[model samples]
Target: MATQPREESANMGKSTWLAFAVHILTASGALWALLAMVAAADRDWPMMFAWLGVALVVDGVDGPLARAANVTEKLPTWSGAALDFVIDYATYVLLPAFAIATAGLMSSPYNLIASGLVVVSGALYFAYEGMKLPDNCFRGFPVTWNMLVFVIFAFPGLQAYSLAIIVVFVALTFAPVRFVHPVRVKRLRPLTLAVAIVWLGSAFVAASDGMQAQGLTGIGLAGSSIYLLVIGALFQLSDRMRARSAE
Candidate 1:
């Protein structure tokens, strides 16, 4: 019977290392994002967005893997959430900010201001305790500046429009609305995952090629964007309905 506790402790030791490996893999995605910025500086759009895509994949899988590994229970000393937030800020915010500023996505002066706004608002959003809702939605737009950067780069003629869009997203960072978390929101997980996959493929297509590719990608982006907006609205309405029922 006494040996049982030792066996459990040994098993936990192994599990903790597995959990830590997951965190390392996720954090490496941030380093990958930084390298993506180097590609951005070289004006190699394909490689830059490719690295971002890799980072997105890492971020997407790590959480599920960590949970399955029982990370928190195995390694109470390690704070996976803090590590995730740090990597998220780098991959989702800082690298995109760098790309926008250097890639001429917006007009000269406005690009700098827009990039700064993204960084500032993203930092605030990350620090906001209410960023994550009880229902697992983001309290506001989740600071997906990387996607915004990809969209802007994919559509060169929209330089003027990009500035306006950036401003709106920055504002939305502080807005009192919920944004659907594609993986976390359980209502339409399969549909959300499908749209996200399509959107990502479109993003790569749009980033790599010319007008024909851009045209198809644009349609995909528009469709996916509408789906996300509708999902967010559904989350809000559902939460309100639940609250009223409780009362």
Candidate 2:
């Protein structure tokens, strides 16, 4: 009789865990989608960028939260993972593409080709690397990097030149190089950490300073580009360090 009761209790615990896991995953997805939609409709570049930043911050926490809650261990196999990936791609890739198109970034034939290449390259890299498990290391430039590049170039006055720079960075994102996960700080190379800090710091400064610029487009563009380049270099160094440590 006691054994039966204990078994039932265990089952209930499992059900509760599963429910919590699903809720978290669903909430994360909804938040990302909502932000994306807001960005799409408002067409306010700063707001769009702010939302993306928020999404990134949320994403950084989800994994750890799930793990700490043991959600990954107890939740339905692949359900949470699948939903997470879908939401990620939607927020990171599809929405950005829509933003670019709606913003008329593709008005020119050259711009159109460049944008298409960005999409293709990013898609292929995602498809190839995303198939693996644990995702300890990324095989190509992360889409986040490319998306940041796009956001930087999307500024009003720098639109044309920024778009060109975006195309170049997109190509780099597809380049056959590994990018290290930021979570693995112990294995992070010095150069990678330095670059990452500089890049992120620059972004912070730019965002802060631009708030006072009123309508100065170049201010944000220049700051964001510097941030992206440093970020890229950090990714490269981190990836190399991670690969070496793993070996």
Candidate 3:
């Protein structure tokens, strides 16, 4: 019986190490962002977006893996959530802000303002309490600057529109709508993941060769956006019903 406790302690030690490894991967995404910036400086949009995609993949998978390994239980001393948010802000907000500004995607004054807005608003959003809804969805737009920048980079003739989008999403950082978490949201998880996968692939292709099936990739991105809109609407409707029931 005493041996059982020892065995469990050994297992927990392994779990803690596993969690640390995952945290390292999450931090490495920021390193990848540095490489992306180098690519951006060189005007290699394809390679830059590719690095960002890698970071996105790392961010997406690490949460589930951390949970599976019982990170919090095993490593009570270290806060993985804090580590995650720090890295996420860099990869998602700061790096993309740099990319848009450096790539000359938007005109002078506007580009500078847009990039600054992304970094500033994103910082505020991270600091905001209740950023996550009660239902585990993201409250407001979750500051997906990387994805927004990718879309703008892929589609040409949208320099003006791209600036508008950056402005709009920055405003949306304070919006009340609940954005679905894709994998974490219980409702429509499979559909959400499928659409996200398709969108990621489409973004990759679009960024790699902006001229290859440009129209089709644009359509795919639009479809993905529509899916998120539908999900957000459904979440709002559900929340309203829950509120009415409580009343």
For model 1, the superposed segments whose C-alpha errors exceed 4 Å read: 1-9, 210-215, 238-247
* Cα lDDT of model 3 by residue, 1-247, tens digit: 8999999999878877898897787789878888988887888878887888899899889989888887788778888889888888988899889877878877788878989999999999999988987667888889888877777776666666888888888888898877888878878788899999988888877776742326778789868966865687577988799999999
**Could you give the C-alpha RMSD of every candidate to the true structure, in order shown?**
2.5, 5.5, 2.3
Candidate 3 lDDT trough over 10 residues, lowest sum:
206-215
- For each candidate, give its TM-score against the true structure: 0.89, 0.67, 0.90
lDDT of 3 at 231: 88
**What are the per-residue Cα lDDT tens digits for candidate 2 across 169-240?**
676675655555455333444654454544444444444554222234344445544543455356567768
Best by TM-score: 3
Q: In model 1, where is the ten-residue run with the lowest total lDDT? A: 207-216
lDDT per residue, candidate 1, 109-154, as tens digits? 8889988999999999998998888778888889988877777666
Q: Rank the candidates by TM-score, best first.
A: 3, 1, 2
**Which of the predicted structures, 1 or 3, would earn the higher TM-score when compared with the native?**
3
lDDT of each: 0.82, 0.58, 0.82
Full candidate order by lDDT, most accurate first: 3, 1, 2
Model 1's TM-score against the true structure: 0.89
